[model samples]
Target: MNPTIKDVAKLANTSKSTVSRYLNGSPVKKETEEALKKAIKELNYHRNENARRLVRSKTQTIGIVVDSITNIFYPSIFRGIEEVAKEKGFNCVFYSMTSNKYKESYFQNLFFEGHVDGIIMISFSKRDKQELVEIAEAGFPAVVFGDSAGIPNIISVDVDNYYGIAELVRYLHRIGHEKIAYISGPEDAAATKCRLAGYLETIGQLGLKVNPSWIVTTDWSNEGGYHAMNQLLADGDFTAVVASNDETAIGALRAFQERGYHVPTNFSITGFDDITLASWVYPSLTTVKQPFMQMGMKAATELFRRMEHGEEYPSERHLLKPELIIRDSCRKISEPIATLK
Candidate 1:
């Protein structure tokens, strides 16, 4: 009778899956690998062609897909992924898709071709949701760092954008600002939708008027925020502005400065992300701080779990908390002003 993997596992005093992982060149404990080797030699086990075909060798590499490398938010996440991968003796490969769905699909296919053991995607396009769902259904090891949309099968780690925005809005209201404007990010982004929803719901809950002109949309860029701020100034009057992220907030700050309007003094503005530049800039910035590095580490950890357990791993969603960092950008007001200019 042929010596099966079960026999090797029984002799090595480990799980059959552990023996299989050792044989497949996946990460296993050194002691377990040594025991498996000794057991295989003792059993004179020669892996048959069928067993070899059924068990594929792992590349011991993980692929990370991001929107853009130049974005300030991604480095910490990359660092987190790197730290975890190093501990597992795994390598990391990065793919910058520039928010393109086609590029995302292309890199995703690389995993099927055995280029990577798993993948972690950040800020994926909404249109790619179906594809992602399909991959998870097919038992691909993947974790996402954006809106999971309550999909039970897909693993994701995300900050509560709605809560963060709502908290910021409440803080602004407490500081005596009634007429607040919102500068949103791309419409398709999950964070944009959540943050915008928070803004709308909170404004309505606070009985503040939701001005049509006060809500403007822009991409996640400083230039986009600048142009959007300019448009807001032209359209209506508001006491304060709520930017989607730190970059936009900084850009809006520049716009206010260019027009000779002092932040918090003339108009109050707040941003999200609480990036490095948020503090370094003059006057600083009051924003919501998302756990970027922690999100990355959690996503990578989940991916490895999925990879190790395959379809047996339970689906999970890690919703991280956001911290509201109050700084020099906003001020207490006695009443809502009629206009900035």
Candidate 2:
């Protein structure tokens, strides 16, 4: 028989648990790491794939399907996931899919085909989410960070998108912006639904009128924001803008300058997701800050609990709150003097 983990631990003068932890990807002291490495080399001890499969019901790895790296929110969330996974001795495997077609199939093949022990999908589109429900209904552990179909085996973590956008629109209204141009993400996205609902609902609540021409939907990207802004300008007559995200806001800011409209002075603009770029622009952005990394960490924690307890793992849904960051890009205008001189 080959030397098992016990033999290696004994040679390294360490407890079996320490060896196990190290093997599972947990952090170990430098001295212990060196000792274990030396002992494993000397004993020629290697993990038995067949035995591991027979006795242990885990791969000790996690799979995270995230949105495109271009989205500023995904990186923050990825860090939170990686941190928790490391503590639990589980390594992470990440796959990024931006569009509808890419998200569904890439994650399906990765999860059902036995590549990872569990999976977490972040910021996925709405229509593609039904596939996740099916996977969870089959008794597999699946977690979604943004929007999900709310199945039993799936843990859903959602940001308070509805109220967050509603408050932003109310703020724009409070500052005397009656005519607002709205830049939207792709219509199929769950976020688009939530954000748009907030905008429309809040506009009605405030008794404000919205022109149909002022709404333009596009991909959630910087270039998408740019194009959307140009289209809005062609047919729009508004004093304020509510962009879908920071990238979109940044692009719209540029469009404003190219058209000789100074931000906050001529047009007060607000965006969602207070990304790093939100502050670095010439005039800082006024936007909502979603807890991206915290959400990721929470999802990972939930995954670990389910992995250990299976049926006993409590299926919980978390809704994180969003914060409003006041900056120079959005300005207050008097009701009587809404237009810039």
Instruction: Report the lDDT tens digits of candidate 2 across residue range 1-341.
Output: 88987888889997664576566544455777899999999998887776355332467889888776666567788899999999999899987776657844456555444578788877755645567655554345567787776555567887877777887899998888899878888876788888988888888899999799988998878899889999998998899889888889999988989998888778888899888889999789999999888888989988877666553466777888889888988777773434656
lDDT, model 2: 0.79
Question: Each prediction's Cα lDDT score?
Answer: 0.82, 0.79
**Which candidate's lDDT is highest?**
1
Candidate number of the best TM-score: 1
Q: Pull out the clashing pairs in model 1.
A: none
What does candidate 1 score on TM? 0.77
TM-score of each: 0.77, 0.73
User: What lDDT tens digits, residue by residue, belong to model 1 across residues 1-341?
Assistant: 98998999899887665666566656555666788889999999998887677566578999998776776778888888888899999999988777445454566565655788898878733545666666555445788788775567778888888999999999999999899999999977778888899999999999999999999999877888898899999998898999998898888888888988888888899999998899998779999999888888888888888888665677887888899999988988884544645
Which pairs of residues clash in candidate 2, taking residues 3 or more apart in a chain or in different chains? none
- What candidate 2 gets wrong by more than 4 Å, as runs, is 1-55, 67-71, 95-115, 127-130, 150-153, 335-341
